[model samples]
Target: MNFDNLKNIYQFAEHFQKEEYWQNLFQHQSSNPLPITNSPSIKNSNIFPVCDMYQKNNYFYIDMELPGMDSNKIQVNLLDNNIIEVKGYYRSLQENCAYYLKERQNLQFIKQIALPNRVEERNLQFSYKNGIYTIYFRQN
Candidate 1:
């Protein structure tokens, strides 16, 4: 509660507030990092949505958490047979509202996921439930 304690607390908060701090902390812990293509429309490579890719029951699935995101605003494109690009924006529930602790901000995000094998035969589908978007591919 003293001046030095308050100063130290402020310094700690300032350090965590830096974008680099969070980026380095969560720096792509996945064993296989997907290759992201640079495009003029997308910005901020740091805005990566947590994703998991796996195969089960003859289906290749990519489940990505996009909390509070509008389904209408999301776009999933098959860049190729083995690569997919997901583009979307997170919108706040209220406009011009002041937030004391806002972890999720209104920002654009583009995430590309590379599959282990090419999903030919054109059987692709997706579903969103409980803020998690699951993309399904029929394994041939």
Candidate 2:
């Protein structure tokens, strides 16, 4: 029919094709972790710790930046699925003081990570040292 109508049809088909391509690319596997939703603790805070994940010697390692955080304040858990969740609270030392410029504040944070492979819950371990929180998992 009209050239403009043909162009519109082409664009509509391209949009659906693009969406289908991504859906195929991101199709979830049995080992894939589910989506992460914002918890109440994270909804009001903008703090998300930087992290790195790697594998070595049949083990998966996750290292997260949590400067000035104590081991007691951090908790780690392996979900029933293949996700590892890290949760912690940070209390600002200057909470009682008012400053013209303040960047850090008391906050609760949650970070979820999908393991490269399935890991046994009993083999999960973690340690916090020198502002780095490390999680270890033996590949199953």
Candidate 3:
């Protein structure tokens, strides 16, 4: 191919790589953008909360975003001394009536992570701040 053709191909690829093209291509066409919390009953669609885990310096951390959730609704448990389980329910509706049962399905999320090593369970601490759960552990 001539240099002109090569230049044109490069330009096409460069344009395709732009953020706007990809964003428009992947944009959901639905008028109502459904979040994971909106449709827990969707078949084959996993709505589990996303998490980030890592070890830094003297602490191992597992963080998950849980916006609009009450801290009291969340439960954390350490299983088998090595596996940690985080469970919670998030509700968007507040009316307490059986009539809404069919219309409202609370968003429940659970995430479990296995520790790389035994941790000081007695000293392990966690905090929920700024719409995130942060579990901290120091290696035993």
Candidate 4:
């Protein structure tokens, strides 16, 4: 066996040996979540919220960044059994405060997450704690 081939084999074996590898593979919805015929929403639609996801057993964990936003304003929905949609706007309650530097104070984000496996629409759960948004889904 050539050195390159042996390296590839060793990497494959190492990947399979780690539980995190499997978890990460399933977490991002089977390696890719690219949608066919992409659609745009809200101006500057190119910006997407940074996120982290993980899969364990049959549960999918999604951690999305949505700082300074009220939980009541956020919306989470399941579409067609595989697509997860998140929509929300952050409106500051303070009206009298004037700032010279204002950035990301008022924000809105709409993003769809695709799952490789079927999900129960009613079983989804979400929690926002300390500027982090965490959503959960179970594979069906």
lDDT, candidate 4, residue 69?
A: 79
Error of 4 at 80 (Å): 1.6
Q: Comparing candidate 2 with candidate 4, which one achieves the higher TM-score?
A: 2
Pull out the clashing pairs in model 1: none
Q: Write the per-residue lDDT of candidate 3 for residues 20-78, one digit (tens) a residue.
A: 66766677888635322221232212324667888889788888877778887888888
lDDT of each: 0.71, 0.72, 0.68, 0.70
Regions more than 4 Å wrong, model 2? 1-47
Runs of candidate 3 with Cα error greater than 4 angstroms are 1-47, 94-105
lDDT of 4 by residue, 90-126 (tens): 5654678877776554566677777777778778888
What is the clash tally of candidate 4? 0
Q: Which stretches of candidate 1 lie above 4 Å from their native place?
A: 1-43
lDDT of 2 by residue, 1-140 (tens): 23644565565456546665566558787675544423222234322666888889988888888888887779888886688888988765675686888777667888777677878778988888899989998777
| RMSD list, candidates in order | 14.7, 16.6, 12.8, 16.2
Expressed as tens digits, the lDDT of each residue in 50-103 for candidate 1 is 778899998999898887787777898877667788888876657688768875
List ranges where model 4 is wrong by over 4 Å.
1-43, 92-94
- Model 3, position 97, has a per-residue lDDT of 55
The prediction achieving the highest TM-score against the true structure is: 1
TM-score for each candidate, following the candidate numbering: 0.63, 0.61, 0.56, 0.60
Q: In model 2, how many backbone clashes occur?
A: 0
Q: Candidate 3 has which clashing residue pairs, if any?
A: none
